[model samples]
Target: MSLDIGDALRSGIDDLTGEDGLLVGSVFLLYSLGSLVADESLSAELLTLVFESGAYTAEQRAMVDSFGGSPFALGVGLPAAVVLVVLVALAGELVRYWAIRSFAGPAETETDAFGDRAVMAVGLGGAVALTTLLFQSVLPVVGQLGGVATTLVGSIVGPLAGLVLLTVFVYLRQEIALNDGGYGETVRNSFARFMDDPASIVILLVVLGLFGLVGGLPSLVAGLAGGDAAVAGLPVTVLTRLLSTVLGAVFQTLGIAVVTDAYLQVRTSARESAA
Candidate 1:
């Protein structure tokens, strides 16, 4: 199947840039909140929350509080971060659904509402998160089997595994938005679609990765240069972040829209070929 990469790219950009500011603003807000919630700052309340959750005994919790909450405590911190990630993902899925439905002329609405799609988002996020944890958990075992070649390969394997899992997540999440099925049904159906044209999954990941790399360049350079760029006596980090945030918002909004249209087109072609 020949995908008109240029046409898809142009249409996606037009749809995203043609929208009002609200979509961009919403994306920025979600990304920003995710960064904020992931911060490691801890407080007495956080200490109680963390310790109270059984990271430590009751006596330990009390003792930790006696140190003026210490400079380090995170009761519920990790849990809160996890919840926030799910929330951000849910928000992204809602954006994807609303954008695809309105912009792509899907003309179908089986599971269109945000509430209906929440389970799908959680499932996607959970799958990705679990893939991460599972890979991390196996590192010790990998380490123990250490030969030089084995250790060398193991070092990059986790990240490579993550990248592949993420590609799967990207494809499946778009299906969840476009297909309008329950989580299990979505997974089964989407996997079948994936099997039909696995190349499409690779294409999706490459396009999305290019978008990310393009959007992230300035920040990337700054980080490599030590996060201290300046423009007109203003901190470069501030300006880079602002620019990156805007681009990230635009990239995500367009990425889903473009992929949704492409997915529909691909599925239609597959059915025709099958017949």
Candidate 2:
């Protein structure tokens, strides 16, 4: 039997409820909030440095310095900020492993596998981070070296390539969580799985992307209206950030559940065919 995209979506919705759903949701919430704090803290530090450099006029310096006093400003060193971000990312991946296992079914979701899974999650997360950094770092350089024509092409191709990589890594995470394979094997299998049914994966990705865009509208509007400005006694930017964080967490959980269910269906079909 081929994959039924609608059925997979329905299954995902079902998986994203009850105790397991709450567990996943909570972890994602913390993960998103941690990320937000880390990002704002780093931004604050950068702004403070720029203001103190004496490049800006006194008025500009004073304005930026005032922002340095905001609650998000941590005065953390770059090394410490990076470590905090890495820790948050690892925590996110750990919960992702648990969510995938739970969605896969009870037999695959073994309590004793925590230690092994944590190690695997670290490997998987690191690989993904490296892959993303490589693409980001390399693509811009490649574009620069080639001149305006190449830069234009890169502008279009870069995002498409990034999306494809994102899809592949999402499957890679599923593979790692569901199987007891080494890093290399998991990576190969994820690519192979995508090759087997790229259309479905792309379709699912588009659907999820649309959902994310819709969910982010409130934040977008808030930013456009005035990100730094206050609205009715509340900080619009902070409020929007919190709203976006919550919405992002919910959508991320749903997306993972959907992908996990879809992967299971494909794997089951492949097994039956082989049998």
Candidate 3:
């Protein structure tokens, strides 16, 4: 029951164009901000490395630094973070919706799982934060734990946790539909589905790899260029930083889209086979 990759992508694109899809995209955009906030330390470090190393000009560095230690920064960052979280959530929902639509083949389901949607958005937002923290702090400490097991567990846990979260969302959606249930039921179903699909569990890593390849590279290059421009002149640096920030957002959005779409495809095919 392998699916056509092209059809799957087309369905996802079509979904992305609807009013609900736009809402989903908007939510994902918000949700992505949560990811950005969670990864602030990493973002900061990366920016510093890129800018200070002649990737950007001193003026550009100064502008980014201006937000430092400002109370208003929180006000600005919070809204942005919320938006990012919503974006990720919406993207995930779109994928799941498409997966269901694709598997069921033209059968329409009620888009009424508000509880499940809320739980998914909040849960995923938390997961994003936790995953960010784990990578930033836990993994480094794990490296110092001085054992192969500890190192290996530390290395894999965060990503695996993320994969599990993704699977849970998919599982919960289906289970809730089947059981006439809500959030708690969906959560339980998510755990069960993850356990049932080790192969698809591994598929997450592949999906993420592809995400980095397609969605990450453009921004990486953009950052490099922006950083270089920033170091060269003040005006150029300012523009460069601004452009790079937008570029980062775009890349993040696209990355989520790719991951959501691909994971949905995998989940849909697997579910059809199981049935």
What TM-score would each prediction reach against the true structure? Answer: 0.65, 0.79, 0.48
Off by over 4 Å in 1: 20-83, 106-108, 112-114, 129-155, 228-234, 273-275
What are the per-model numbers of colliding residue pairs? 2, 0, 29
TM match of model 3 to true structure: 0.48
Candidate 3 or 2, higher lDDT: 2
lDDT agreement of model 1 with the native: 0.57
- lDDT of each candidate versus the true structure: 0.57, 0.70, 0.46
What's model 2's TM-score?
Answer: 0.79
RMSD of 1: 8.7
Instruction: Tell me the spans in candidate 3 whose CA falls farther than 4 Å from its real position.
Output: 2-6, 18-23, 30-38, 41-184, 191-212, 222-228, 231-275
Q: Please list the residue runs of candidate 2 whose C-alpha ends up more than 4 Å from where it truly belongs after superposition.
A: 42-73, 108-112, 133-160
Best by TM-score: 2
Tens-digit lDDT track for model 1 on 1-275? 53455666777777667753346446555665453333223223433444444656678555544432222223455466445445554555555555665555546435646566656655674566556643543342243344456545655776677667665545466566556666677777666665665676577658777877877886666555444446787666556656766677667677766766566666676668889
